[model samples]
Target: MAKLFGNLELVLIVGLVAALAIIGAFASSVVVDANSILRWLHLFFGVLWIGLLYYFNFVQVPTMPAIPAEQKGAVTGFIAPKALFYFRWAALLTVVTGLGIAQVNGYLHTAMSFTGEGAVNLIGTGMWIALVMAFNVWFIIWPNQKKALGIVETTPEQKAAAGPRAMIASRLNTLLSLPMLYCMVSANLG
Candidate 1:
């Protein structure tokens, strides 16, 4: 495996294989079905999005200034772009699939309502926050990052401005993520 694939590609391939195996198992099981598969996809994508968000906040941002200027280009110019591509898209899919689950499970309105106190309120709050973060990922950060990373052409000043905007929005999402995670987990609590 090491001879055939670099570390990153190998890791990605392994993850994909594991995901496929889980899906296969679900398909084979009488207890699981398509809806279960979709729910799993939602959860999987949500983890990917939030996981990347944590990576950016907990690891990447703090380390950037310390990275050598020459190497910063590799991180910012290459790795960051690839990671953000998956990050933003995963965010989008998470929202889509989560909503799909809510609709399928017939709890869309109930979950959104925050009707009862306690877990309902908490879960509703998290759902709303996640929705906002997803919106920011798609509508705000991704667009700004395009300019920041020169995915599209822009003046240096514009790129500089865009970078901070993206960072701020990313951080905002990171901050909301804690509450979002809490609500998501607590929502299912009996």
Candidate 2:
């Protein structure tokens, strides 16, 4: 049991197989289609991105100063870099899958251009918000994070400038995630 739970890849594989089996069994109620697959991928990676974002904002960042100076290496050296890798990739994939979903549903242009009525307009709002957040993740947050976490060598002054920039960008994403999620959910339904 411990061994099974210890490996994330193994756990995810087993979970995927199990879910496929169950969904297969209940195929009458659930239709597996391209749009659905895209939605699943979008949801999965969105969770990963947002989960890591929260972890950074709520857990790692706040606790960094509290960690013993000598012990800071454990986080800055090992944990944060790896977490950031997943965080950024997840953000990328989420955007990709979301765009795929929109394209498949034949609303990509209308939703993004905001030239349509009803749900397209609503979803456009969410899409734009997500695009902004993704931009922050890749462009602003990531570069600043590299300096702040010492992934990139910098002078003390530059590094000092980076930390708060990264944090504020991260917090901005956190604030946007709430309404972004709401817009995504409510767009089609409402």
Candidate 3:
């Protein structure tokens, strides 16, 4: 039991299989179905991603320059990497779950359309913005971060490029978040 629990991959696989079995059984017994569960996962992962995002933007980044140079590597090499692992994965999951929710709720097409009533158009704009942000996360940000963190080797020029790429996209996400959040919150109000 100890050995089984010790391997993270194994634990995750077991947990995932158990969760699927439970969900399968529950869905078979219930009428409402599993969309709610997907939505719940979306919300859970979104909160985790955005919460860490704000932490990095609003807290960690600002504090970094203040730390002594000798100690900086500890934060950057160790702590920051771990945080970023979760951050990127959370962001990925957030996007996946969010799209799942939209699809489950039958809003994917309309939200992508940018047509229909005022509220729908508004929601669509937000959806588009979120989609762009997610794309940036998956494409621009994650790839750059790998180089920036030495997760992948690169030239100084490439490393330099990574910083700006990641920063700009993150800032763009920050900018989009304000309006995106508003549209999402107001989505059901109408």
Q: Can you give the TM-score per candidate against the true fold?
A: 0.82, 0.95, 0.77
Q: In model 1, how many backbone clashes occur? A: 0
Q: Note the clash tally of each candidate.
A: 0, 0, 0
Residue-level error in angstroms, candidate 2, position 13: 0.8
Deviation in angstroms for 178 in model 1? Answer: 0.4
Q: Write the per-residue lDDT of candidate 2 for residues 1-190, one digit (tens) a residue.
A: 9999999999999999997898789888888888887888899999999999999989999999899999999998899999999999999999999989988888899899999888788889999999999999999999999998899989999999998998899999999999999889998731
Please report how far candidate 3 places residue 99 from its true position, in Å: 1.9
Q: Where is model 2 poorest over a 10-residue stretch in terms of lDDT?
A: 181-190
Residue ranges of candidate 3 with Cα displaced over 4 Å? 1-32
Model 1 per-residue lDDT tens digits across residues 13-108: 888898778767776664465567777788889989999999998999899999998888898789989999899899989988877766776666
Name every residue pair that clashes in candidate 1: none
Displacement of the residue 92 alpha carbon in candidate 2, Å: 0.5
Greater TM-score among 1 and 3 belongs to 1
**What digit string (tens of lDDT, one per residue) describes model 3 on residues 1-190?**
9999989899978987997787778876764445777766777777877787788778877898799999888876897788888888887887777667767777767777865677777777877887787888788878887888788999999998997788788888888889988887787622
Q: What is the C-alpha lDDT of each candidate?
A: 0.83, 0.92, 0.78
Error of 1 at 11 (Å): 6.4
